[model samples]
Target chain A: MKLETTIQGLCASLKSARAEQKIIGFVPTMGNLHQGHLNLVREARKKCDVVVVSIFVNPIQFGPNEDYDSYPRTLEQDSQLLETVGCDYIFAPSVEQMYGNKPRLTNISVSNITADLCGLQRPGHFDGVAVVVTKLFNIVRPDYAFFGEKDYQQLAVIRQFVRDLNMPIDVVGVPIARAEDGLALSSRNGYLSEENRQIAPMIYKTLKNAEQELLQAKPLDEVLESIKVALTGAGFIVDYVEARSLELQKVETFNQDVVLFVAAKIGATRLIDNLQVKYIS
Target chain B: MKLETTIQGLCASLKSARAEQKIIGFVPTMGNLHQGHLNLVREARKKCDVVVVSIFVNPIQFGPNEDYDSYPRTLEQDSQLLETVGCDYIFAPSVEQMYGNKPRLTNISVSNITADLCGLQRPGHFDGVAVVVTKLFNIVRPDYAFFGEKDYQQLAVIRQFVRDLNMPIDVVGVPIARAEDGLALSSRNGYLSEENRQIAPMIYKTLKNAEQELLQAKPLDEVLESIKVALTGAGFIVDYVEARSLELQKVETFNQDVVLFVAAKIGATRLIDNLQVKYIS
Candidate 1:
């Protein structure tokens, strides 16, 4: 597998791949690869002729008070995991390489969609995500880009961005990979204490139970309240638990494509999870 | 030359071109097919294997009170002009074809650089320009995209967008094209009456005189004042006349790369022009 640390090197490689008529698939991630990231790489490997994975802990995406400095960086282990998953190229640019001497003044803002859920709690988080993802998409010039459904709002925002911008890339959302105990895999899970780790699975469990309750025609507000109560009862600080249309807009009826999204804090670690649920009337 | 009005058709054609390893150069314009627009096409033609021209009078770029309704649509004549210039394709998507049922909610904003000159007069103008140009860049996926320096701040904003986003395409800023009378060519120039047309050249003349006066080492404030006064004296309603760094930053000294920008109203028509200058100590 080829490893590229600079945008120039990645483009040079992609140019050659384009010459040879290769279908490139890109999986962009903040490294410290878990099974979830590997699953995205595996999805790319299944679909495209070449798979390129980018591992950069994007500083801009984290809020100033959030975990920018504390974010994990395990490049060596991540590289080995990617190689095992058959990723063809690993683009691991340094912070300096990604952002030069001056901070970027260009921003891509997706309105409406980014005004809810995680976007509300973490302001400018998705804008930072939007900008860096756009930069990576331009650099990779991939035919297909894979993102995890674990970040449901982010996936929606990216899809909206690509559609609105008329970008050539096809964004595919991979299903959220979970632990055997049902906890959604996340790098931030590293911050969990052993006691908090024992409590994390309950967040996903409440979401799954909420999905079932939704099928029983419980009022969305009641179902949401139940989920929030359940999480809080289990020592999780509830951020929000709501049912939304796939567009991230609040939906009253479960008649159409809707997702149940949950964000809560277990001790100091914040975790998010979502489940797509359908109601048959 | 192929004419595509649909995004799907354009992408299909571009896919074949990519397969054949053609280097596409794109020139996006609001179609009235002036000499200035053709100059951008010519620049693309000189460097690329294929030249694609998109004539979209982007409504979003015009302020609510601006001249969007009166913007010319001369596609047939524009296509004839593009053919004469060896443009390989003309993408003349209708307003409906370009933007579907809903208006775009995604915006690309370049801060600091877009805060001066024309941006001050036309709020949300550069944002609209940035969004549409980004959309065009993605749709065409050209190797090189050309813009005229006639819109100096626009060129600078685009450069910043491309650099900050790390878009794969190289943005080429073609030098401004002017009429024999030295008035900078613009589609809005069509709005001028015969009497206004006769007086329009003075805007350029005042800018030229100011450029010459800058070599005399006068303070920038005095130089700017003189140019504004000259335009106002010539029956023009001056918007602003200022000297700024090439990056569109306000500059106190003309010691480095700087551009003098001018905007004025000739009767009902608003006109803008700029000149790059260097000072030798």
Candidate 2:
């Protein structure tokens, strides 16, 4: 596998790949690869002729108060994992290589989708995500880009962006990869204390309970209340538990595509999870 | 010229062009097909293997009170003009084609630069411009994108965007095309009354006057005030006339790369102009 750190080197490699009419697949991540990320890479390898994985801990996505400083960086282990996944290229750029000396003044801000859910809690997060993804998309010029639905809102926003901007990229959403205990796998999952890790599974459990209630024809409001009550009952500090249309992000009766999402704090660490319900559409 | 109204057709055509390793040049315009726009096409023809011109009268760029309703739609004339310029393809997608039923959110925001200039008069105008341009860049995937320097702040914003997002396309700024009378060419020039048209040259004349003063080692404040005084004295409602770094958008001394820009209203019609000054760098 080829490892590149500069844009020039990466583009040269992609250009050679494209010249052969090779289908290019890309998986963008913040390093410290877990099974969730490997699953995205494996999916890319399954679908495309060449797969490239980028490991850049984008500073822009984290808010000043968020885990920017504490985010995990497991480069050596991540590189070993990528080689084992049959990845073709690994792009690991230093911050200076990606961003110049001056702070970049232009930024991308997604509206409607970013106005609620995680966007509401961490402002400018999606904007940062959008800008970096745009940069990576341009750099990789992939035929298919894989993202796991573990970050449900981010997936929605990115899918929205690719459509709205008419970007010539196929953004494919993979199912959320989970740990043995049903906790949604996240790089941030590493930050969870042993006790908090035990409670992290509650986030996904709460969503499952909400999904089950919707299946029973519970009113949307009542189902939401029960999920919130369950999470709060577990001593978790709930940020928000929302049931929104997977496509429109509007409150909907459980007769259409819906995603029941939850974000909450267990001790000092925050966790998020969601489950989709394709109701009788 | 190949005429495509849907993105699918355009991309399919572009794929063929890419397989041949042709460098595509793109000129994106809200079409009224003024000489300023034609000049961009002509420049694109000279620089690229394939030239694509998009005639999208973006509704997002217009404010609720602005002239979106009255915006020109002369596609036949526009296409004929583009054909005359030897443009390879013309993308004239409808509002529905560009934006699906549920429009995906936009993410391009240009700040501070938009704060004091025309943005002051038309709030959210630059944001709309940035969003539309990003969409165009992604769709066209041009090797180089061309813009006229007439929209000085817009050129600055887009330049920053391509840099900040690390977009692959090189943004090339062509000098502002002008009429024989030295008035900068704009489609909005169509809205000017003949009486206003005659006085429009005053905007350019006053900017040139300020450029002359700066070259004579005059203070930035003195040069700016002199231009404002000249325009207002000429029965024009002066908007703002100031000098800023062409790159950084800060009020810079008369020591380096700076652009002196002005905006004013003659009757109800507003006009803008600028002069780029390269001091001893």
Candidate 3:
């Protein structure tokens, strides 16, 4: 359980693991680990000889108006949770350690995949993710990298870049981890007020209902409108509720595997969740 | 020497080499190998246990109006030259092999440093270079990558991205390979007519004179003007002649390491060259 706070230290640790012919697995996260992140680490532990979990609240990914300054930092609790999950290394680098004094001159942009959904609402978000994740991949040089299906568009974006750039790492998307009430686990959930926390479960429930409606040949636009109405009815300020193909492209109806995506603000905290609906009929 | 035309073939070959703990050195080039490119290979031979040279005339890096279609690709002769230079593998992937039917969705861009000089003249040039070089680095995963200082700005761009991205490979800039008459050897030089070939060496001479003038504390603007006049007098269309800091930023004087860059056209062939001026005073 090594805690590597610098790129040099992380590389040194990884070099040793690589020398021993170990299959390294990487899980990159924005710290404040929840059950969702721990599940990723546990999956890494099951599949790999060494599992490295990075905890950095990437400033680049957040827009100027977004939650960059107030993002959660729970290293003490996050480290404990990761250790309990049998993680081999925790790469928790400071912003200075990662970016230094110079302006970030290098950027990795993935088009098409990043042009819709969360990408449109949060511009430059996935490009920031693309850049940082690339740096992490270069630093770790892992055999496998784990990403949560909870961030469905993010997972798609990563997969797109990995294939287009010909990076030699398998990108595995783990299923979304949800609460007993069906609310998807997110670090941002901590920002929810007690009342909003209770209402957050509706985000997932809306997706489930939308999934059922779509699979039963309901009109895509109608089901989407219902989701917006349901969330807005429950005191959630609907950001976007749309049905997209599994590739995250706009769809008129569910002919193949379609997904229901929802994002909204309950009080000041914004939450996002999506569910895939496979048409059996 | 093995010629690997497919990514799988190259990886399989590299796998056996890595298993034996070989340090790989890479030199990326556009074929029609000249003395400059061969020199790069020879240096790679001297520094690494296994040398892999990639001859990819990357279409992404060339502008629509540029010479991508007409770019000379002498793979047969180039392969022979690489063999002579002790290059262990020539990873010459075809356009189809490198990029399938899909569009190139991933792009790596470097700003600031690429905001001037050749970067200004050719829009999206360094970005194209950035993306292709990143893909090459990912594919080869070399311990060291070599570049010719002849393309000073390109070398600077590569170094910046590799460092900013925290790529493990060390970037080595080999000295510019020159002919007896002082013209920087280039594949583009093949396009020069016999009369233009005689006039081509003037590009190097102009850079040298600019270097001496700047080192002698001459006015930077005056020296730059002289370079343009000298090339224009030789029946060449002077594109730009400017002085920049070694970091490729605009400089007012020769108080530090300065570089004199020149680009011009003779007949239909465009030529570029530069020389470094180390101001000792």
Candidate 4:
């Protein structure tokens, strides 16, 4: 597997692959790889001739008070994990390399869709995601880009970005990979203490129970309230626990595809997860 | 010349052109087909094997009160003129074809540069231009895209967009094409009465005089004030008359490349023109 750290290097490599008419698949991520990110790579490997993974812990996506500085940087282990997963190229650019000495002046914004969910708490977070992903998409020019459903709102935002801009590439979302206990695998999960790690599974458990209740035709509001109460009762400070359409739009009644999203703080680490449930009437 | 009104047809044509390794040049327009738009095609023809021109009078660019509805749609004449210019393809898509049935939720915005000039008077105009141009760029995937410098701010915004977004295509700015009387050619010129048409030359004339004044080392502010006063004195409602750097940023000194821009209303028609002057000192 080839490792590229500069934009020019990666473009040159991708250009050669394009010359051979290779179908490129890309998975962009921040370093400290988990099973969820590798799942996206495995999916890409199955469907594409080449798979390129980018590991740049984007600073712009983090709020001023967010854990940007403390975000994990295990490049050595991350590289080994990618190699074992049969990844083709790893683009791990430095902060200075991705964003030069000056701040970026361009921004791509998706409206309405970004106003709800995790967007309400992390202002400008998705805008950061939108801008960086736009740059990466241009740089990679992959035939298919893979994004994990773990960040469901982000997947929806990216889909909207591609649709709105008429981008030629396709966006594919893989299901969220989880721990055996149902805790959605996240890089931030490493911040959890031993006891907090044991309790982290409660978040996903509550979501699964809510999905079951939804299947039984329980009231949407009641299911949401019970999920929130259950998480709060388990000592997690719940940020949001609500049901939304697959497009992340607010739905009055759950008669279609809906995802129950959850964000909560257990100990000092914040964790987010969601489960999509189809309603049959 | 082949005319394609649908995105799929144009993409297929351009895709075959790409396979043959032909260099494609694109000129995007709203299509009343004046000398200025033709000049862009001519520039494209000189440098590329295929020249595709798109005539889309984007609705999103125009404010609710602006002349979007009244914008010229001279498809028949425009097609004939493009054929005469040896253009390979003409992409004049309908509003619905380009934007679909629903409003576009995605927006591409360039900061700082777009906050001034025409962007100030026509809010969200550059955003509309950015979004549509982004779409056209992706669809055409041209090796080179051409723009007339008469809309200097729009040209600057596009260049910024390409650079910021890392678009693979190159943006080339052609000099403004003018009539023998020195009036810059524009589709909106069709709105001018014969009497207003005669007075329209004064806009370019004033810019040229301002350029000459700046060449004589006159203060930038004095030159700008005089130009605005001259246009207003000639029965025109001056929208803005200012000097800016090539990037459309405010210029406090005349020691670098500067463009003198003017927008004014003559009778019921509004006219805009610009002249670039290089500073020796």
DockQ score of each predicted structure, in the order shown:
0.88, 0.71, 0.84, 0.74
Candidate 4 lDDT, A1-281, residue by residue in tens: 99999989999888778877789999999979999999999999999999999999999899999999999999899999999888999998887887777546678998998997889999999999998898889889999999999999999999998988888999999999999999999999999999999999998888888888888988899999999899899999999988889888787777999999999999889899999998887
Candidate 3 DockQ, CA atoms: 0.84
The sequence of per-residue lDDT tens digits that candidate 3 reaches over residues B1-281 is: 99999998999999977877789999999889988998999899999999999999998889889999999989999999888889999999998888878777888889899887788778999988988888888899999999999899999999898889888899999899999999998989989899989999999998888877876777888999999999999999988888788888888877888888888999999898988888786
Native A-B contacts reproduced, model 2:
0.92
Judge the docking of candidate 1 as incorrect, acceptable, medium or high.
Answer: high
For model 1, what is the error of residue B150's alpha carbon versus the real structure, in angstroms, after optimal superposition? 0.7
Largest TM-score belongs to which candidate?
3
lDDT of 3 at B265: 94
Number of backbone collisions per candidate, in order?
0, 2, 0, 0
Off by over 4 Å in 1: none
lDDT of 2: 0.87
Give every collision pair in model 2: A108-B107, A109-B107
Better of 1 and 2 by lDDT: 1
Output the better candidate (1/2) by DockQ. Answer: 1
Clashing pairs in 1: none
What overall lDDT, based on C-alpha atoms, would model 3 receive against the true structure? Answer: 0.90
Name model 3 segments beyond 4 Å from true: none
Colliding residue pairs in candidate 3: none
- TM-score for each predicted model, relative to the true structure: 0.98, 0.93, 0.98, 0.97
* Model 3 clashes, total count: 0
List the RMSD of every prediction in angstroms.
Answer: 1.3, 2.3, 1.2, 1.4
